[model samples]
Target: MELRFIEINNLVLHEYTEKIRFQKLITKIEEEGVQKSPIIVTKIDNYYLVLDGAHRYTCLKALKYKYILCQIINSEEYYIDTWQHTISKDDYANHIQILLKNERFSKLDSEKDKDILQINTMNDENTPEPLESYIQFVDCLNKCNSFKRVHKNEYSKDSVKVIYPEVDEELIKLLVNKNRRIPAGISKVNLKCGRILGVSIPLQILNENTFHDIYIDKIMNNIRKYEETIYLYEGMIL
Candidate 1:
């Protein structure tokens, strides 16, 4: 539950970012003039690897902010899951033809294969790197007619589902260490407790010039303001 403003350069991403979403976030944050929540991270050795809010981290970096607020969680306090991507039938039909013969993936031939594109089977030196292959796969889907992430598939006639493998902290650290990243919006991290949200911190005070005094003052003020604001909610977050 520790929250503090750390230098942006000290933060590292575990996944590749989507450029279109990154650009949109930059515009949205500029218009709002306040960040709704701090990006979540876990300390790993010398770097704080981002667990969530990849786009937010990149947006602040793009805006030339030297330090960004982060919600620091213990590395062992969270688990990771994978998002299931769905694409239009038309796009799937078109791409499946190309993928069926692709070397990097295997066709979903059995019921045990999980009914999704098997994209993690790079076996030899000649094969494209795992990160590069994943980026290419998602980029093609992005250019398609329709794409979305779904929690449950409706078994619709027009939708094609793609389930990817879930990642763990070990693999995440390996990727960061090698300067590689998976496609964004796939690694879903579930934390043990409630996250700090809706703080609405002003963007103007996050600059380098104000990092020493004004930033700390505002953070303390916000902490005092929300010290007694906690409440219990029993409902599901979906």
Candidate 2:
């Protein structure tokens, strides 16, 4: 029952403890520095196993992060219960999303620290895009980044129409919600397509059908218009 701080690649993971708060960790790494905290693992003769902090190992590897600090314990006697939790990537990401927004973690203020361990809270104008918008597109980016797939399969209903490779499905829904089809002289109903897309299209020259359809080209165009968005493009499973 000795506590020894150690750092090693995943030689052994308790066969559990997979879903770790990844976004927060990555943000802390990206903001404060990569070596914020070490993980705790169990070590035997030649290989070390994980008792806790499996997410740390998996995420770092996924991000191609080379090194991490870990605490290597020397026995199985310490764990009263084997790490019996099972979590998927989606679950882990969702959990991390919550942690990233948590008040406790949000108040860390790493900017003042010389060592800069973690940016638990940051007020940057550009941060992660809303989960609702980015989730679907994240899938596509992850695939593209992994060189797995360049585009996505079309939805059954929209088979004839091309679904833009990088357009987030949820974002489309959001835009649809924001743009109402209110017919009248009311100001609220004037949420035009050109304005939402941040482009200029003269109303006089444009026909009535122009703003009615939400197409993939328009989505791609909007993304290009907001080229400086911070997290709208993090790669995922699409």
Candidate 3:
């Protein structure tokens, strides 16, 4: 994996971030003075499209950091998946009611399962832009009593599950090209061999204008220092 610092402006975010989460990250980075992990990105034409860590990217940019560390990966090596959303029963009903009033959304006939609902855009004038639809959905979702993104649909009488159509890389790139973004916590990127974490590069180092070579040396040293601790694991990590 390639890890290096690049200009923050060189990156593009494909997902809308949570304001609260972004603030929290800024606070954490300020207190710690180190970036715990590099944001993941894939080069698309002339720009680097963020595949993960949208919150981190925005937080650092908000902090006025000119350079941010990133992990560059191949665009063809990853697949995108959508999260299954669950919310409290009352909130779910309220959300559905809200969608019905908005012409942008169309509620499809659900599966045999009563607790699960399928929702999508109607392709009409009322339909907001691709990014806005996700933003609206997230706004409505956050107002719910209890909302969670799940991998498996666990039937719960107190909660209801909602599913949207899967999105592919082409769609993601298209959204980015159009200056749009999917909402946070919905699009999931599955990368082979997982991601590198806990590198803890200090913020000061990132700000140095002449630290590229030194940064590479430090990274090589870090690789040696952590070699014993790194191991490959198959299956899901909770």
Candidate 4:
């Protein structure tokens, strides 16, 4: 594997499915003055498609860097896959804010003056009426059948379990069946417990199609049971 510094304009992003909402990440990168991970890419039809590290790519792009460090790979030899949080810590409070501002909450009709939900004051026991309604709204979002591929991540033994909202199952099925790529930013939500954030469409790619059923089932089961740990490929192989 050769590490190369390629011009940003030369790379093509195909089937990328993660969002680039990394304000904190960008700040960290600026502070550190270096990127920790080199993006992985494969050349297809003379265009380099990013196989991983789209977030890092966006960060560098936002930083106005002309060239990026990358690990170029032979597409035929290695399979590319992705595992991402449907909802990250940064999205938790934002989702709550969306629910609060949405007009669907009838209970909040009288509180028209209030736009933001004060999450710090609410908990399972002493949650305010408006906040409780927001929690139910988030629950409804998760229970929708339209979302097929969802997963939960419990970071540690004592961490709270977070559930993602429902995503368009048919859309995912179509993408996989057609052997196409999934795009970034499906849907994002937060857990009712206020402990974990949800990511609606955490995508995966495989070199061989043989692992589809096994992995798909794993994601579905994780959504059903809110699994604590999720397995995905993460490494900087030389």
Clashes of each: 0, 9, 0, 8
lDDT of 2 by residue, 1-238 (tens): 1222233443444222213456666665446434433455554445565444555565555555434444445432342221111223343344333444543223233233232212222223254544332333223223221111112221222111111212222333342344311111101111111112222222221123334233324434454334453343445658
**Which window of ten consecutive residues has the lowest lDDT sum in model 4?**
194-203
Q: How accurate locally is residue 179 in candidate 1, as Cα lDDT from 0 to 100?
A: 72
Ordered by TM-score, highest first, the candidates read 3, 1, 4, 2
Q: Identify the superior model by lDDT, candidate 1 or candidate 2.
A: 1
What's the best-to-worst order under lDDT? 3, 1, 4, 2
Q: List model 3 lDDT by residue over 1-238, tens digit each.
A: 7887889999998777877888888998899898777899988888898888888889888888888888899966788888887777678787655776776677767568565565675444353444355546656765775767766856665666766656766666667776766666878888864576757777877677588667756775766334344665644577
> Which parts of model 1 have CA positions greater than 4 angstroms off?
87-107, 110-147, 156-160, 209-238
Judge candidate 1 against the unseen true structure and give its global Cα lDDT, from 0 to 1: 0.70
Number of the top-ranking candidate, with TM-score as the measure: 3
lDDT, candidate 1, 1-238, per-residue tens: 6778888999999877888988888998999998767889999899998888888999988888877888889967788988876777678777654755667655454234344543343333464454444545555655664667677644444566766644777667657776767666777899875576666767866775455455546655666334454776645586
Mark the regions of model 4 whose C-alpha exceeds 4 Å error after superposition. 15-21, 81-181, 185-238
* Whole-model lDDT, model 2: 0.34
Worst 10 residues of 2 by lDDT: 182-191
Candidate 4 TM-score, true structure as reference: 0.38
Name the candidate that leads on lDDT.
3
Candidate 2 at residue 85, lDDT? 16
For all the candidates, what are their Cα RMSDs to the real structure? 5.6, 28.0, 5.2, 17.2
- Compute the lDDT of residue 12 as modeled in candidate 4: 58
